[model samples]
Target: MNVEYKRKFTAVVTALALVGIGVVLLGRDRVNAAGSGSITGTVKLTGTPPHMRGIDMSKDPYCVKQHENNPAKMENVVVSSDGGLQNVVLYISEGLSAGEVSAVPSEEPTVDQHNCMYSPHVVAMDVSQKFKVTTSDQTTHNIHPLPAPGSGNIGWNKSQPPGAPPIETNWKAPEAISVKCNIHPWMHGWQVVVKGPYAVTDEKGNFTIKNIPPGSYTVTAWQEEYGTQTAKVTVAAGQPGKADFTFKAK
Candidate 1:
C-alpha cells in the first residue's frame, strides 16, 4: 500500500481503539456508580391505643358507613408508641448530598377533612413544596398547623358550606407540621415536612426508601398521636438495610 494510505489506515485504527477504551471505562464507571442502598422495615405501635376524640358520628351521614362507627376505635387506625404504628414518617435525616428543592415543586398533595376527620391523618411532603389542605364538610373548618418553633402555624378559617367549593390552600415549610380543624374539635392531622424524599407506612406498617447512597444515617419515624421514634442505620452499596422503630403508649 502507498505510505500515505498506510498512515491514514493506522490513524483510523488508533482512533477506533481510543473510542472503544472510552466506552469500556464509561461502563465501569456506571457499574461503580450503581452504589446505592435501601431502607425498609415494619413500624409497629407498641402501646395501648388512644381513644377516638373529635369526631361526631351523629352529624355526618357518611361517617357511620365510611369509617364504620368510629375508625378512631379500630386497631389499624390507632397511633401507638408501643402498639407499633400510625402516621409513621420514616426518612433520611441528613449527610447524603441532596438536590435543591424542586423549583415550582411537583403536583400538590391532598389532605382532606371530611365528616370531622382528617382523611389519611398522617401526611408528608418535601420541604418548601406546595400542598393542599381541603375540607368536604358543609361546616366551617379551620386548618391549624403546629409548625416548628420559630415557624408560625398556617391557619385557614374558610367556611365550607354543603355543596360548596372545598376550603383549600397551599403550605410550604421545612419541618414536621401538625394540623388540626378547630371547628370539629376532634379533627386532627399531621404533616411531616421532610427536607427530602420520605414515605409514610401503609396499613401493614411497612415502608421502604430506595436509591440512597451508602453511608450512615438517622432514620426518624413520627406519628401524630404516638409522637416520634428514631434509629441509626448504616448502608452499604447495593444492600438493603432495615431500621424498625416501636413506640409505647404514654
Candidate 2:
C-alpha cells in the first residue's frame, strides 16, 4: 500500500511540471505575436521612363571588359517593362514613437560594386545601422559619400583596391547620401538613411517593411530620380498594413 501511494504521488508531480512548462510557452508565443506588425506595398511608375544613357567605361579598360557581355547603363530611372519601379527607398517618414525610433535593424545592408556599377543602384538603411561597401572589381576604386553639410553626418572617402576588405560604417542622420567612385567617373549610387523601419523595392517594385508596431504612420517612397511620395497607413498587431505609391515621370 505504501509503495503504491509513493508511485501515484511521483506521477502527479511529473504531470504538473509538464503543464506549467506548456503554459509558459503559450504565454511567450502570445506576447511575441502581439508585439509587432508589418507594412507591404508596391511602387510603380505611371508615365514612360526617360532613356538612360549608356555608361562610357572607355577610361578604364577593366571596367569596359567587365561589361563586355552586358553593357552598363545609367540607373537614374530604372523602370521595368511592366512599369515596376526599382531602387526606390520606402521608410516611415513620420508617426514613430520614441521606442520605435530607437529600434535599429541588426541585419547589415550591402552596396556591392559589380561590373563598374553599384548593384541595387540604391541602398536604404535605418539611422545608425551598419552597412558594408564591397567591391568585385580587379581595379582600385574609391568610396566617396557626399552628405549635406549641417546634417550631422560627416563625409568620408576611402580607396578600395582589388581584394580589399569591406568598408563597414553607419550614418548619423537621415539623408540621401550620394556615393561615387572617383576612379570610375560613371559609378554612382545613393545610400538613403532614415529612421525606423524601411524597405527597398525589388525588381518587381514589391516591398515589405517589417517589425512595425501598431500605429498609423506616414510612409514615404523615394526614388533617386523621381523624388518622393508619401502615404498614410495604419498597422495592427500581427497584421500587415498596405500602401502603394505611383511616381509620375517628369
Candidate 3:
C-alpha cells in the first residue's frame, strides 16, 4: 500500500479505538446510574389510630363551599385500615457519601394549595434544591413555613393571590418544616428537607427511595403527628434494602 494510504488507515484505526473507549466509558456511567440500589419499606402504625378532627370551614364561605358535601378533616395522623400510615417521609439520615448528599435535583419540587388543602400533604426534597409553592384556589392563600430552630432554614410567610405566579424557594439546611395556610388555619402540610434521596409514604404506607449507593444507612421515617422513627439499612448494588418502621399510637 502507498505511504499516504497506510497513514490514513492508521489514523482511522486510532479514531475507531478512541470512539470505542468513549462508548465503554459511557456505558459504565449508565450502568452505575441504573445499577444503584434502592430502599423500600412500609411505614405502619401500631395501636388504634387517632381521631382526625373535622375542620369547621363555615367561617370562610369559600372553603365551606369547596367542601360543601364532603367535609374536610385534619391530616395529622392518617392510618390505613390495615394499620399502615400515610404521608410519612422516609429518607437516608446518615452514611451517604458527599457526592450522594450534594446531588441536588435540577427540577424544582412543587407544593400546590388547591381546594383549601395542600396537595400531597407531605413533600420530601433535597437540601439546597429549589422548590415551588403555588396556589390554585380561587381564594387568596398564605404560605407559612415554620422551620425548627437551628435547622438552618428560615421561616417565611407570604400571601399568594389567585392566579399569582409560583414562588420559587429553597432550604439551606435539612429539617421537616411545618407548612400552613394562614388564611385557612385548617390547611396544613409538611416539607421534609434532606441531603439525599427521600420518599413519602403512599396511602397504603409504601415508600421507595431510589438510586442509593451501596452502603449501610440510617433510615428515618418522620410523621407529622407521630414524630420520627428510624432503622438501619444495608444496600447492595442492584439490590433493594428494607427499612420498615412502626410508630406507636399516643
Q: Write the per-residue lDDT of candidate 1 for residues 1-250, one digit (tens) a residue.
A: 6999999999999999999999999888655643446788888755555665444555545554556754644222554343446568887776556552233347677777766677777778776667776667655566777666666446445555455564444556556666766655566677767766577887667888665657777888877656667788887766777888776656
TM-score of 3: 0.87
Q: Per-candidate TM vs. native? A: 0.72, 0.88, 0.87
Against the unseen true structure, what C-alpha lDDT does each candidate score? 0.66, 0.90, 0.88
Tell me the tens digit of each residue's lDDT in model 2 across 75-129. 9988888988888999988888888788888999999988888986899999999
Cα error, candidate 3, residue 127 (Å):
0.6
What order do you get sorting by lDDT, best first?
Answer: 2, 3, 1
Q: Model 3, range 166-195, lDDT digits (tens) per residue?
A: 999899998889998878888889888988
- Once model 3 is optimally superposed onto the true structure by TM-score, how far is the C-alpha of residue 100 displaced, in angstroms? 0.8
Q: How many residue pairs clash in each candidate?
A: 16, 0, 0
lDDT of 1: 0.66
Report the candidate with higher lDDT, 1 versus 2.
2
